[model samples]
Target: MFEQIKVFFMKIWNELIITIIVGFFIRSLKKSKELVKPTINELLNNIDYNSKNWKEEIDKVLEIKTTVERHFPEYKDYLLIQYGSSVIPDNKLPSDYDFIVLLLGYPIEGNRYMHNKGTISDESNETNKDQVDIVFRDYLSFLFAASAGMPYENSVIYNGKLVKGHQGYFQWLKNITKNILFDKDFLIRRFKEKIIAEKQEFHKCLKECEEFGHDEYYVIRAGYYYITSILQLRRIQNFEKVITQNQVIELSKVRSFYEDILDDNIRNKYEQLVENLKRNNTLDLISIDDIKEVLLYIGEEYDKNK
Candidate 1:
C-alpha cells in the first residue's frame, strides 16, 4: 500500500497536496473517544429505546422521498447508505444537530451519511456545509436505531452538490428537520443552524487575525483557516469541561491535546504529509535535494519549541 501510494502521488504531487490540504478541511479524522465522553450511555442519546415520536419521525422522513425527487434529482440513483433510529431520553433541546451522516465506504463513494461539522462548531461555510462524508463499515456502530432515515447527499467535488442543486440540498434538510425521522424523534436541525454559526465564527476569527496584525493575505487564507478555527474552539470547549486554566499551563501547545482525538496511525499519516510538504516543496515540483531542505526546516520548528 505504501509503495502504491508513493507511486500514485509520484505522478501528480501537486494534485495530492491540493487534495490533502482541502480534503483535510472536511474529512479530518476526528479523534473518537477511546472511552465515550463522560456521559453515561444515557447522556449519549435523546430518548429511551421505546418512544412514539420515534415512529413519527420515520413516517415523516419516508414522506419526504417525494421532496428529493422533486427538488434534487441526484437520489434518482443513490442508495440507502444508512438507516438508523434512536431516542435521546433526556429531552435536552440540543446544542447542534444529532444525525451523523456518512457515505458508504468500500469503493468509498455514492449515497452516504453526512458529518454534521456545523453542529461541532457552528460555522457553516458553503463548501464545508455541502460535504458528503463516507463511512467505513462498523465505524459508527451506533446506527442501529429503529427509526432514523437519512438521504445522504451525493459526493460534492466543488461547484455544487453533484447532480442536485440547492433545491435537493434543501430537501435533505427539510426531511431531517421534521424531527420525525430519528428513532426517538429527537430534533437534529441544530446541525444546520450550527454550520451557519461556524461560518460566522470563522469570519470573526479571521477578523481578529487581521485586527491583531496577522497579514490577511498570508495569515488568513483557505478553507483550512476556517476548519482550524472550529477545531480550536472544540479544543477550548472540551478542555474547559475537564481541565482548568492550570491544566493549560502549556500555553503554546499545538495539536497535542488533539493528538488523542485521532488514532496514531491516522495522525502519523498527517505527519508524513508535513514531511512531504517539507521534502518536496509542496508548492513546487522540484528535485529531491530541495525537499531535503524543507525537511530540515520542519525539524527546526520542533527543536525550537522543545
Candidate 2:
C-alpha cells in the first residue's frame, strides 16, 4: 500500500514539475517578444516632412537608430545614415525620406531577413506620411562604390549624417573615399544613363502636363533632376569633387559661375527655368521649351566630353 502511494505521488510530482517548466518557458518567450518590440515600427509609416509637420517628423526619424540596433544586433558594425532632403532642407517638400543602413562587414545569410524587415513600402504606399526610402548595403558593395567614386556613396562620405554606429567606422569610410580612384568609364556611363533617364521622365511629365492641366509636382521634379545632372556633368568635365545637393542646387541658380559650361542661349533659358521653379509653386511663367532646350544642351555637352 505504501509503495502504491509513493508511485502515485511521484507521477503527480513529475507532472507538476513539467507544468511549472512549460509555464516558465511560455512567460519567458512572451517577455522576450515584448522586450524586443520595436517602438519605431508603429511610428515608421507616420513620418512626414511636409511644410506643416516637418519638425515633428524629423524628430521621429531621428529615433530610428535604436530600433535598427535592437533588430540587427547580429552585426556589430553598421552605419545608419540620413542623407538627401531629409538632412538638407532645400526649401521644398522632400519627395521622400532617404536613409542608408550600411553594414560594415561581410554579408550574412540572416541579413536577408533583416533587410526585408526594414524595407519601406514606398511604391505601394499611397500616403506621403510613410514615404521612407531605405538603402541597405554591405561593406564590400560600399567599398566598391567608394573605389569607383559613385555619387551617392561619395555624398554619404562627405555629407551624410550618422544616425547610429561607431564614429570610427564612418571615419574609415571617409578615409577610403578620400583616396578613391574614379572610374572614368563608369562615371561617363552613369552620366549618360542619368541624362537619358531624366530626359525621358521630363518628356513624360510634359506629355502628362499637356494631357492634364498643370503637374507642378512632376515638372518641379524634372527640373530638380535636370539641375542635378548638369551639376554632376560639370564635376565630371572639370574633374572636380562632388558637392552637396543644396550646394549644387544653389550653384545652378547662379548662372554667373557657370558661364564656361552654359552658352548664352542655354543660360538664358536655364535662368528662366530656375527663376520659375525657385520663386513659386506654379510653373506658368516658365516655358516647356526652355526645359527641353536646356536638356538638349546638356546632352550635347556630355556627348562631346565623353
Candidate 3:
C-alpha cells in the first residue's frame, strides 16, 4: 500500500513538472511576439525622417543654409522642404523620406554647390539602400514640375515638425501647390522623359540579368514599370493627368486586353513572375527576353493608340 502511494505521487509530480515547463514556454513565446511586433504609432514615430536621430543631419543642412546665404546673398530667400512617401497621409510605414531645398532666387552657383555638397556622402550611400533621398530644387523648376503632374506632386511639404526651416516658406510652398494647375505641354514632356527613363532602366536591368543570373524582383519591377509607363502615355495622349496609384484596380482590364486582344503570354508570365517574387525573394524563373518582349508590345500598342 505504501509503495502504491509513492508511485502515484511520483506520477503526479512528473505531470506537474511537465505542466509548469509548458506554461513557461508559452509565456516566453508571448513575450517574444510582443517584443518583435511594434504598434503602428511606434513604427511611424521611429522612422528616420521623424526620429530625433536625424536631427544632426538636419542641423548640418541648416548650417549649409548659412554658408549658402553668405556665399550667394542673392539666394537668401529659400525653403527647405521634406516630401515624398514620408509625408503621404496614408503612408504610415514609409521606408524612408525625401527632402528638397527649394531656392526662390536663381543663384545658379549656390544652388549647384548645395545640390552637390548638401549630403553626407557616406550616410547617403547607406541611406540610399534604406530609401532616403535629398535634392535641391529651384522654385521655378519645382513649380513647373508640380504643374506638370510630376510624381512629386503627391508628396507633402514638411511643416516644421521634423526639420527646422522657415514656416513662412513652407506655407508658401503649400499655397503654391494648392493653386498650381496642370500644364499640357509640360505633362507631355514629362511623359516622354518618363518613358525614356523607364526604357533605359529596363535595358540596364536586362543587361545585369544577362551578366549575372535572372532576378525575379527586377523582372517584376520592370513589368510594373512597363505597365505604368503605358498607362501614363495613354493618359497623356488623352490629355489626362497620369493616375499613379490605381494600377492594381486596373490590372484585370489590362490583363484581359493582353490575353484576349493581344493573345500574348506576357500577362500570364508577368502575373506568375510577381507571384513568385512575392512568395520567394530570390527566383531565377524569368528571362530578360520575356521582359523585353512585353516592353516591346507595350511600346507598339502605345504607338498604335497614339
Q: Can you rank all candidates by TM-score, best first? A: 3, 2, 1
CA shift of 81, model 1, Å: 9.6
Task: Give stretches of model 1 more than 4 Å off.
Answer: 1-67, 70-72, 76-96, 102-306
- Give the Cα RMSD of candidate 1: 25.6
Error at 1, model 1, angstroms: 99
lDDT of 1 by residue, 256-286 (tens): 5346335454344334433322222232233
Residue-level lDDT tens digits of model 2 in 17-101: 9999999999999999989744333454455635576544544454444544555555556677777555765636534456777
Winning model by TM-score: 3
lDDT of 3 at 254: 33
Please give the TM-score that candidate 3 achieves against the real structure: 0.47
Ranking by lDDT: 2, 3, 1
